[model samples]
Target: MKKISIKIVYKTLLVSTLLTTFSCKKVFDVKPQDQVDITNNYRNVYDANAAVIGIYGQFQTLADRYIILNELRADLMSPTANADQYLRQLNEHAETTDNPWADPRPFYKIILNCNDAMANFDKMVADGRMTSSDYQQRYSDVGAIRSWLYLQLGIQFGSVPYVTDPLTSIDDLKDASKFPKISFDQLLTNLIAFMGDGKRYLDVYSTSVSTTGATNTSLNTTVDGYATNLFFINKRCLLGDLYLWHGDYKLASAQYHYVCELGSLSTNGSWLYDQYLVQNGDGNNHVDIYYGNSTDERTLVDNNNGGWRAIFGGGVGTLTGQEWIWSIPFDKNFLPQDPFVNLFSNTGGSYLLTTSQLALDNWNSQTQQNGLPYDARKLISVRTINGQPVIMKQLYYNVDATSFLPTSVLQKQGRWLLYRGATNMLHFAEAACNDATLGTSGVKLAYALTNVGVTRVYDNTWPAASSLPTDRTNIEQTFLDAPYNLDGRNGETPYYRGLWYRQVGSRTRAYLQPLPAALASDKLGMETAIIDEDGLELAFEGQRWGDLMRVALRRKDPAFLADKVYNKLLRDGNGNAAAVRTKLMNTANWYMPFKL
Candidate 1:
């Protein structure tokens, strides 16, 4: 049993407290706490609110490490010449204990904050300092944050000390007898049970408090008057992820389905299905692609045109709100400044990471529905800056529109996207494809979701439907029923369209052709397509390695993940491709060394 020293706990608490004190002043409107007296802090609702904000402040520190560890270890990202030895080691899957990102202390610091807050929140409710409603909402919020951090720990470290009670010192974690380390699978079970069925958690902040000028100002309001859903975690999405890792396909599908339904309700149907796609000149729905004139022929669309890049660029408005489920905002004015500007920007940034050549090849291999030779998303995702290809999604705000290049002046503020619409739909499709109860219908539904979307008119008579008997041709009707139906289709005299009618599917939205008809019966092939689509849509947003790792672990196929990373390195002309592949073929080698 190795004694891991989490010396950052007190330091993180002090830093996060100071950071949240100023950052949350505009929104929560609470006074700064110069000192965090954990025993005496739960005096009122304001204190509870500040505590939760502090947790987020600490969690925000993990943004850079999260993206770097998740993306670099997997495909789609390569270290640049300017990248330090640590970055190169991470990319090569040969990280040593000296790598700062390998330390688990930062993650536990946030978890410790969560545990302390939840304990005090319960006491606040019991002492009549806060209402039970407020306690439940805030407690569950912190609990979800803890669960998410543990999940990341499990993903990156293989096994971790599962601590729930607030600790007096980090040294207690060193004693294996007192706090036993648990495997990733056991961690999932605990998280799934802790998060529950998602009914107990509050969907949004509903507390009303009296402000100086206004009476009963709802805390559900946006941050700094911006319509952003960046402050809290989505309970259902976290539970869905837990179940997905736990191998509970039906439960995972249900959780993801709830998120989709919530998205529909929250955005008034605009966020549903492929409604985000625009109707192009071809009379078909497609992701808004910006093709410049013949002389400067390249994709250069913006948020105004509903381009795919809008998902990452603009303020948290309609375009971003529809896609980004949960995000962590980092501003230059805040204590923890935006980290991406330094990692991704070439003009004013260190330019440590870039899009791998394999990702470019993956995007270039696709033919769009318009008969274009390459995927339009690549144009929006990666742009050549200073003769080097940089991930442009998060750096859009710091780039010049006319030249579509990084600007010399950088505004160090960005959002770390956690969960979103496309991810929800993809997870649902993946779960449905695996659930035996759904059968071949699940495969068709999954394919349709990633391709052209499910519709009774088009999909009912789809050639793939033949795989199911006449009686079960409409077997997907089960999903069409209440609670599960994402498609707005139902039996009525004058039929009104559901969410699926507007759904053009992820691939179709990217202007890519639908998968082959034969894949409808091939579950493995369908899963591969879904994972590939994940790489295309969610690249560099920090979910790549997890997606690949989850699928590989599920199928017990290390080669599935190994081959991809090997191909990425090989394409980049890295000599370590074979060695990396050989190492990754062993499941134990997938995770980093668990050190404090």
Candidate 2:
């Protein structure tokens, strides 16, 4: 099924007038609200489940705005010629209160929905319609969602109103100071506490699907019966992420290690990783796990257009269970338009570009093998259409190449990935690097973590379909077969290699994308190794800006941010790089100012 068709019992409700009022003033003034009948909705577990689905639905509504706010503020993408004035302002870091994209209403709306779900779910438990354990699980789930929303709001908007209660009447809004705005640090503190609650009730394990009768090829090929478990937030992933944001390296590493180790286990009880290979006509190879593999049952024309692909191109249960930890699913029936396609697809109109040297240099690495000297992620990550590169990883359905118009099939809907194994692996590596107690083990873990993603690139060509290359020496030799290898990094045995040999055409600082020569004098000589790895492993996935923020904040150096973004703009050849840099260097420009 392209969408999870659980018939939601409660209607999708938004306190639209309240949201508007909240956005317009520091103190919310509301008229007496009319009492609406709502008691019937929480009478049973089934209805409570429907309320949970509605929470997920609220996330769906925030998806496009999420990507826009996160990505545009970073340097990974450029405003297209078709970009509206508001987009141009955002891309240039000149956004003010008037920019619609900077509005905090969306985040508040999701938080409001979470508030309602929590209140109603509590009632369900009190009424004995839901078990206590189930109630705890539901609370944990909703809390994680709410915490994440606040974290993002804190990231984009420096401080935001922290409202936890559902406003049913004007009385709830009367206390202006009750909704005190909190800082990002405070927000992280609250988020960590919320995810701690999640850890107590949520299981790290996902339920593998067993029943299967659908004729759709993808559904038939599912590794498990159903993968509904991957849709909601997992405690380990959320905890790890929240801890990382809080700079609690040891705790973050622990959480990330749990997710990475768990991700290695198969839901269907097979190999450690969900691995697949697709051989191109030229005998070149690409990993299906990276670009996403579609079986005969799960193609653009089919009903089963989901799995991890749902995080990008919409479809929920596409893959049974592999790398994707959590995602938001969208269907055209519900959203009316696929925002990803609307923004990046050819048939749709937009002018975002990834043609910068930073993007191209990484694309040229030998390890990212879509083809020799061209990482497989190149074409998939950013497609060069009409001699310009635009983001393409999320576009995976029926679209005319020339026209770039996506069909209205539910398959064309894109998903939003909250967390994945690759990102977690890198997170563990970085967190371990920051942790002193791990000692030598931390170094090895860091090396292994880097290899985990790099290996996926070259592992595609090992030429053995019957077995995974378990031999460390054999894996090293296969990678060494390439045109270039950093000879000194290869230790005595394949298992001991801590430094990977550099590939041809790759810069020394390529892995940890160094600042351009213009900013080299700034002496932030520090390559953001983990952030670089994240770019290669999860580009255009909407984490680039967050990665930048993590580094800048961790070191207490706005120089890192000023250098990376400003230097890119200075070299952008747009003739206005200086003007953009002026706006971006303000530090205040780094975050969206809150209105109301």
Per residue, candidate 2 scores C-alpha lDDT tens digits across 1-596 of 01121123211222122222213321112223412235344564444544565566556666667777777667666667777888877767778788888888666766766787788777778877777766776677777788878878888987667777775432343356787777788888877876775446656423323224322211112122224456577777677778888878788876765554452344553323331111111111112323323222222221123222322333333441344677544443344244677677554535443434556565565442222344444544666666666676656644543344465434455455666656666676666555556554344334434443333223434223344444445443323211112121233433453232221111111122222323211213213655666766577667777888888887777766666666556556556666666665566667877875
How many clashes in candidate 2?
21
After superposition, candidate 1 runs with Cα above 4 Å error: 1-35, 197-199, 207-219, 267-287, 290-305, 404-410, 456-458, 463-495
Top lDDT prediction, candidate number: 1
TM-score to true structure, per model: 0.87, 0.71
What would the per-residue lDDT of candidate 1 be over residues 1-596, giving only the tens digit for each residue?
A: 11112222322222344334433332222333333334445577666766666667667778899999999999999998999999999998998998998888888877876887787787788888877776777788889999999999999999889999987556668889988889999989888878885435747655455434343333355545343245688888888888888888888887787666664455454444443322122211123454443133344354422566666765645466656778766654555767788898887788899999999999999987657778878877997766778788777665665575555454565666777778888888888888877778778778777776665324455654444233333433435443345543433434454555555566776667778888878999999999999998889988999999999999999999999999999999999999999999999999898876
Best by TM-score: 1
- The worst-scoring run of ten residues by lDDT in candidate 2 lies at 277-286
